[model samples]
Target: MSLLNNVFYFQNGIGVLANVFLLLFYIFIILCHRPKPMDLISCQLTFSHTVMLLTGGVVWVTDIFESLHVDNDIKCKTSFYINRVMRGLSICITCLLSMFQAVTISPSTSFLANFKLKLKKNIIYAFFYICSLNLSLYSYLIFYVGGLTNVSETNQMKVTKSCSLLPTNYIIRALNLTVTTSIDIFLVGVMLVTSAYIVLILFRHQRQHKHLHSLSHPRSSPEKKATQTILLLVTFFVVMYWVDFIISSTAVLLWMYNPVIQSVQKFVLNVYPTVTPLVQISSDNRIIKILKNIRSKYHQIL
Candidate 1:
């Protein structure tokens, strides 16, 4: 019932709800409606976000697991492992989504256009690969510390906001950090590159549309709308991610733990997933049309 606890619960609750809503919506689309190209990927991203929120606060939410009489060490390890894995997936999947949208909007003359066929064919495989890789990479955390933390190590990471989650040799710590940061940088770099490509294509497309139709507000195609949404998502994610990454890297390297800084970092971590669904709900024409139809039907029944 502390202020930080309240904030954490609120943020995680909002994030979990938003992600679950989108998860169900995406599933409904895939099952009952004509699925959009982004549906499966978005669904996977939402599921990752939901699990991230639930597991990210394991230290604080341990009461839920305590019912099963799980040890505190086990709780911390579970949280650390899942949180890291989901964080990895979030970046990888966001990069993939941005790259796919770029390809979707690319002109036939563009080089990205050639990959469209192959990308669509292999998209599911890409998801599976990302999941398998993250699961394998972050699984080390659960065992890397040898079950319990070494409080004696000054370089122990204050993960799960309070748990000294990772304690190992400097060499191992450095190696893990290097590997994780390298993968994150590679994924984020992909997002940035594809986002820039998308923005340029959108600008050129808008100009062409205006020139052809001589209209002030040219209507956008569905592909253009989807591209814009993905761009916005990538931008929001990069901004949030860099904030969290800078703080986390600084803490992990320096072995510094400030309560307030960790709190802020936790908030930054949840912001992207919480806001993404709202953005998609508002921007997605299908969601809007569905809401409008439901409203009309309710009004008629009333």
Candidate 2:
């Protein structure tokens, strides 16, 4: 058990470090470059990943303390709620990225072209709305979740490190699950559909324009490249989302019999945030160019 806990801690530490680097890099990009629609969305996504990873790390560390019999109710609940909000925000941002890319790449004659133009103009407003919606939706956790407690035979008060949802009737539980699941399904569905559409559009365009480029030059256009990147991001998000969902949905049944399910669930939840930053950096040519230039400059100075 100690060895397993150490492994979890090490994984969480690496995720936190990766997210921190992403945060710094995105901030620098925003400050140094003219912020386009894609840039704004990328910045938002990076920020979301940073917060999600940080809160996840806090929760994992708290769990370790919890295993040691340290009691910190408020810290546990706070981190839990914050992590939930950040997780929702991460999903929303990924959906936004996929939707934006789909709209941007639609053909001029397509019906979505007009909406794409308008969306590009008001993407910042859309992003703000998404952030607000996620915060508001997940805010319920603050009121409904708290640390478990136990009373000693000697009449002493004891708080457990684990959090417990407040007692609620079946209706409330069903309603909460419905709402959360609905939103998740809707956003994920949108991401998958739009990403597929973007790929189709890119494929058709490439076939039509194949004669324009030389045989030796097989590189795709910048837009097509970016669309491919967004598709990859959506794919990763979908896999992680479903894996976590399955584990969580069946957790009650499996948790008591198989303790490893909880660990796997936690790992699946954190994997996307840890890897997203690296994916974003690799997909963006500008970011890659800047990083390479920095590396060369450092080497020359050395």
Candidate 3:
């Protein structure tokens, strides 16, 4: 087996395990939490991330098998479709998460303060709409290219009997990835900037002894903790995934000339979804509270 195959198997194994844990984590949140607006949204986001990882794992494993001369066309298409859809939905969920945090941290005196109440009930519907929109958008693109196939006995993308779509066809692919990456980067930037500004402004207001109604509340600890968690989440998202985005985009623009770079980039990109949920689990206080409550309840029952 080649180095690439070894890496692929190792990464897929990690994703499979991570997704299993994430699935269980989401179920625990759903069953244990009192269904706060953030809890429900986060539950969906965790579930989406798990599905995305599972789909990516399938793609990685299929690539390894194809490298070894075992090919399955149907699995290729299924993995391609599922991975694209789930990945797209995962991006949308992250956007929603940022927006959710932004609003949660927004001052009650702001014009958009009422938005918090309005959005509380619509999160599930919004997630469904985004998923449906992304599915339709990418499903249409899949028809333009031949799904995955065997590379050939030599195991080279160039030596394959299967052919790629013309460079003109690649325009849509490039455009789609560029636009998606741009949006993801932009939202992350906005989330970080806005969250930082909000926290700073709050600090300044407190320093000045300004009579902000929201900050006067005694329950400010949880609110501040949530804000800090969101900021950390945004930081982790940018740090971990930015390299993958750059590497993947560079590979596509180079037209896949560097197979070694491409393989490594794909591996990093696939691992990101798995890592993101883990970040959320460790960083979010609410999740920690739920876990502690679960442990306590289990002990009581025992």
Candidate 4:
């Protein structure tokens, strides 16, 4: 294998493994443990990330579609479609998580407190709504992506070795970009607002604690830790999202993907999914406790 292929596969394997582990952990929480409000959202995010990473380029790179006699164009369209849907779901649910956490930490009399009950009740509905929204929003991909039959083609934007972006009407492409960018910006904006709200609440609580000299409350509340985790996640996601978005926009405009640029873009596109599970594992106390237990058990067995 080429060095590039090795690197891509390695990154994807790590991401897929981490995401699967995290997905199973969240499932266990729902079935065996009392799940939190944000647990459902986390489950959705992890599942989406897993699918996205898996579909990123594994089949095309492995020539599995050819071996199975699958049409190259169908593989291209399917992979791109699934990847985009999962990407959209990741951002949407991340925003939902942030908003839910903000509501969770709101004081009883605060305006956001009223939505807490409503959000938890409608969480499943929210999932369906986003699934439908993204499914519709990214439908243009099926039209604009196809198997690259000729490497000599100049106008096509090569996304992977097997498929490239086909040309479409200028107006349609422009509208799609506008709508996609608007949706992404709106979601990121909501995350930022919620993050600021959480930070403000944390600051106020700190002041209140200092004023009261509450020696008994030395540890931060669970809500505080959860909000902090969400804030960190949102911040990292925004950075990765914008970087990927910029590269994607450039690809659309240029209508040609250079070899080096394509590799970089692929890496950038998948970075958020790869990093997300690691961040969750590090931040979540439950995962830490589980790891500790596993470690102690291993020692005992030894």
For TM-score, the strongest prediction is: 4
Model 2, position 92, has a per-residue lDDT of: 91
Evaluate residue 279 in candidate 4 and report its C-alpha lDDT on the 0 to 100 scale. Answer: 88
Worst 10 residues of 4 by lDDT: 215-224
Stretches off by above 4 angstroms in model 2 are: 59-71, 151-161, 211-220, 252-258
What is the C-alpha local distance difference test score of each model? 0.81, 0.74, 0.64, 0.87
Residue 110: error of model 2 in Å? Answer: 0.9
Per-residue lDDT tens digits for candidate 3, residues 106-221, read: 77787657898888878878978987887786775355334334434323232112333223346776787777777677667776766676667567657655555454643367
Q: Which stretches of candidate 1 lie over 4 Å from their true place?
A: 58-61, 145-157, 216-220, 299-302
Question: Candidate 2 versus the native: TM-score?
Answer: 0.84
Clashing pairs counted in every model: 0, 0, 0, 0
Off by over 4 Å in 3: 1-19, 28-33, 58-71, 144-170, 178-182, 205-219, 284-302
**Candidate 4 C-alpha lDDT tens digits along 1-302:** 36776787788988999999999999999999889878889999999999999889764445776788888899899989999999999999999998998888888889988898899999999999999999999998998899987756556767787788887777777788999999999999999999999889888888888999876553356666777878888999999889988988877866657787777777888888898899899888899999999999999999
TM-score of 1: 0.90
**Ranking according to lDDT, highest score first:** 4, 1, 2, 3
- TM-score for all models, in order of appearance: 0.90, 0.84, 0.73, 0.94
Alpha carbon lDDT at 263, candidate 4: 78
Q: List the residue pairs that clash in candidate 3.
A: none
Clashing pairs in 1: none
Worst-scoring 10-residue span by lDDT in model 1? 144-153
